[model samples]
Target: MGQRTLVVVPRPDGGFDCRYAHWGVTTDPFSGSRPLGRDWSGTAVCAELDAGYDRLLVAAARPRWYCVCWLDPTLTDPDDVVLARTDDPDRLRERWTEAKSRAVDAVARGTAPDAARAALLLGLARRADACHRADDASFLRDDG
Candidate 1:
């Protein structure tokens, strides 16, 4: 069976929740059974990404909420913080495309997992950093 990344988000009460299946087998909502499916469509992935972004926006206002991508099941640490929150949906969509493209390219070129995963992880980190900087700049402007 092929491996898939599960997107995990923080719950309001505490603990984390796995929300999305990146690729491979996913539970069929109607039947409550796992279905064999390879290659999650880009649209579906983007939808999940959007949901994660929404959670980040909510977290920004509430401070206790957050979302993250769970790359390794054995560990609880988040591989990527889903902080690409933005008013423009298209921007987040573009980020999804870019990240996926980098991952696919790495796999195609036979890059090791360490290098391949880093490309996607770096993309996510950069997006989060950009959002943070924007938030910081806005706060400063408002305070000044």
Candidate 2:
């Protein structure tokens, strides 16, 4: 099966909006292959990068959703504090890719119990990073 990911976006009212992403774990959501039948994928997204980016971020603010790299869908979570931020998509992709590899390695080396749990938490933590950044970006837009 494809790397199944639970895409979570924190709602502004103190909750989360989530969906099951059947693909897009290690792949670029803006280029190459994408999840079959996903509305947020490939050329459709590339055609309107900024608008697409806005849509993805606004999921937490207004409603909607990818630059899988900046989207960094793999390594984000809502509670994370941004250590540093970069607007470069390539750099973000590298960061998330490294994180994903580490989790996969943990699954490989871990014993049965730890393996299963680690596997589950693999892409769970960093989702909030995306949400928070998105929220900030949205706020900036509203202000300006």
Candidate 3:
């Protein structure tokens, strides 16, 4: 399977709206490329939501391999707007579980270029913290 990524954003309902990201999911995949996951960092995620993107689709257009980031189609390049659709919690959860397994396997193999990132994701997923809701005050504070 190709490297799949999910861009999960916060919903007022206390759940996340996970969207699928089609490219630039990982920089390690490209030789000589600098680490570029900053777009999915916690701060970035919060900033995107704070900018009023709640109306976008919350769930993935389809289940992807890895879950991370929040991409606003309006703020991104037209090429970056790959997929958009309604919510599907079951499928999203299934993908999350699958991605966690993939991460575990990738780490155990000890050969994947993204092994370190996989390990980090595995640790977070183990704690049920990968794509779950964030605490508004600490992690996803919205001062609006």
Candidate 4:
């Protein structure tokens, strides 16, 4: 398996202040995006994850929103990351699980945070899947 990155934007209030635009990049085998993900928006929040096999992802969220961020297209991106954890493994997993559960609720309820995050995460997931097919790194590569 290769390294993966899971980025969790922890907006305790579930609302992410989007006024501060975000940005990122992938430094791996492929430099630029071969099949870049286009700009996306959910519940008025805008996000942009690069279409590269492994790449840049920029997004904004509010406290009222709940959503999980990760590499979901076969999940083989060496750069895929999850939220930073502490020395306590149980606490880390607990936090991850809670975030996911809340996101599901947000999706079902259609309220703030959850709904807002769902919009962006779902869109990002679809785009990531599309990139997997478009770019040729749908799974773990023979060489990392």
Candidate 2: residue 90 Cα off by (Å): 0.9
Alpha-carbon TM-score of each model against the true structure: 0.35, 0.27, 0.25, 0.24
Can you write out model 2's per-residue Cα lDDT over 60-134, one digit (the tens) per residue?
A: 343222333232223343232221222333455455556656654555675353453344334433432332233
Per-model C-alpha lDDT, please?
A: 0.37, 0.35, 0.35, 0.30
Q: Write the per-residue lDDT of candidate 3 for residues 1-144, one digit (tens) a residue.
A: 333433454555654544433342332322322232332544344344421221222223332222332222222332211121214433544554455455545656664535544454444445332343221223332211
Per-candidate Cα RMSD to the true structure, in Å, reads 12.6, 12.2, 16.6, 16.5
The clash tally of candidate 4 reads 26
Model 3 lDDT, full chain set? 0.35
Q: In model 1, which regions exceed 4 Å deviation? A: 1-89, 130-144
lDDT of 1 by residue, 1-144 (tens): 222333333344533333333332223321322332333332333334422233322212222222233222222233333334334434555565566666666667776656665565566666543333222223211211
Under the 3 Å rule for N, CA and C atoms, how many clashes does model 2 have? 11
> Which stretches of model 4 miss by more than 4 angstroms?
1-81, 112-144
Worst 10 residues of 4 by lDDT: 135-144
Clashing pairs in 1: none
